[model samples]
Target: MSIPAALRRRTPRGTPATGRGLRLPVSACVVAAVLLAVVLVPLLVPLDEQAVDMTNKLHAPSLAHPFGTDDVGRDVLLRCVYGLRVSLLVGVVAALTATVIGTAVGAAAGAVGGRTDRMVMRAVDVFSSVPHLLLGIFIVAMFRPGVWPVVISVGLTHWLSTARIVRAELLSLRSRDFVDAAVSGGASRWRVGVRHLLPGVLPQAGLAAVLMVPHAIWHESALSFLGLGLPTHRASLGNMIQDARGTLLAGDWWPTLFPGLFLIVPTLAIASLAGVWRERINPRRRSELML
Candidate 1:
């Protein structure tokens, strides 16, 4: 009379995250926790950026001042925590936008063959000819450097690579026997794309996105370094770097270094986990799963 737990998707035995699974593996859990900490510790800690202690200016890492104070005495730790939030925000937003646009374009190119495909791909080819970081700079240049501008700029520049991958996968997938069978079974083109093909290629798109995040974070920081970044109040890792540049000549590494390290950890974690995430997306992987 007691209800049993629902079986996992195609799981043969273990359920990795469900307590019945592999317990997330020690390394995976640690990495995931580290990524979570990058988002959390800064928010939980109560450090003020504007609270100035001129007496303690340029303090080195010590028992009291772990990350040390900046030239004006702002907590490097607080600024880094705040900067992580902003940098991660921009990266996630921009990547999602690109994913959406790329999915549409790539799916269309695959679904609609002949001249439409040729024209769309030609446009894709054009974007490919331009270097992404240079294009990111130019796009950010066109608009005033702010949160939305960075988000939109980076998102637009990123879709080229995604669109190409999507096209390749969709083209090959649309011709599969199952797809033709679905079409012959009276499914609409949209249905075929959405129900079958879209789901098939979406994992690859996600993988592309996860892989792209580190590069995106780096670019965001680089653009900020170049003064084409967010306002200082916004607290992106790049802005933090900008703030620290003046003090760097005198060797204030703590201010710039710690935020940068936090910025990097998520990018690397997500990138490294991309393969796992992609595999999770595959139906075949479900069959291969042990509980």
Candidate 2:
């Protein structure tokens, strides 16, 4: 039973072809759906932050209030939705800020080399020596407790790892045949770095960015929990849990439990997606996963 060449050429690599691209894994798909819901549902349903109903205070999960009410009687479910918004915003912004700083520093160090590289690497070492959380707390303490401070704190503290990754990647890429050809063809150092080296380094940097999101989220939560994140009146997962500390001993678990779950689930989902993306992007790992 010899197959015709045309049929063999048309056949898919790993599965029956239905003229569609490979589908995402079940876990990745589930995570993507959850993330989409978390980001979108809150926009569709508005809730009041200042509308306190003391009559419903400390209520447990029920049909009317699926996540129950907080001490001041704001709908816990709505607060959770709003909290998700703040967490996602902080995570996304912080990760982006870190990535930009890292990319610039790493690209410059790797491209310039010599004195620039040494100084940059030394700076990275100094930053890396400090514990990220402690550094974040100190930075927030120095400035006002708000969204930008937390974002800046997390961004400033977290870029060291990304810088190192990009620097290593660029160092390797700089010596490649194509880059050498571009240099030999009269392209300026800046052009070669931006056009060739930068693009080559972006994939690794992007993966680093994806991985940074969870860390940023956790950092934001930690800051918020310590009352140094968003304003106390603003809804945030960290502050929601902070509010529950006094009530936990009195058997009021829903207040803390729901927000904690909200925080953990999204972080896990994002991390899971990053893992899947990494596996898919790496040829060896993609092959292994397929097998």
Candidate maximizing TM-score: 2
Number of clashes recorded per candidate? 5, 0
Point out the worst 10-residue segment of candidate 2 by lDDT.
18-27
Q: If scored against the real structure, what TM-score would every candidate get?
A: 0.81, 0.85
What ranges in model 1 sit over 4 Å off? Answer: 1-43, 279-291
Candidate 2: RMSD to truth: 5.5
| Displacement of the residue 21 alpha carbon in candidate 2, Å | 14
* Candidate 2 lDDT for residue 226: 90
lDDT of candidate 1 at residue 3, scale 0 to 100: 50
143-167, model 2: which lDDT tens digit per residue? 8778999999999988888899999
Worst 10 residues of 1 by lDDT: 7-16
Cα lDDT tens digits, model 1, 189-275, are: 889888999888988988888777777777788888788978766667888778888888887788878877776766666665664
Clashes of 2: 0
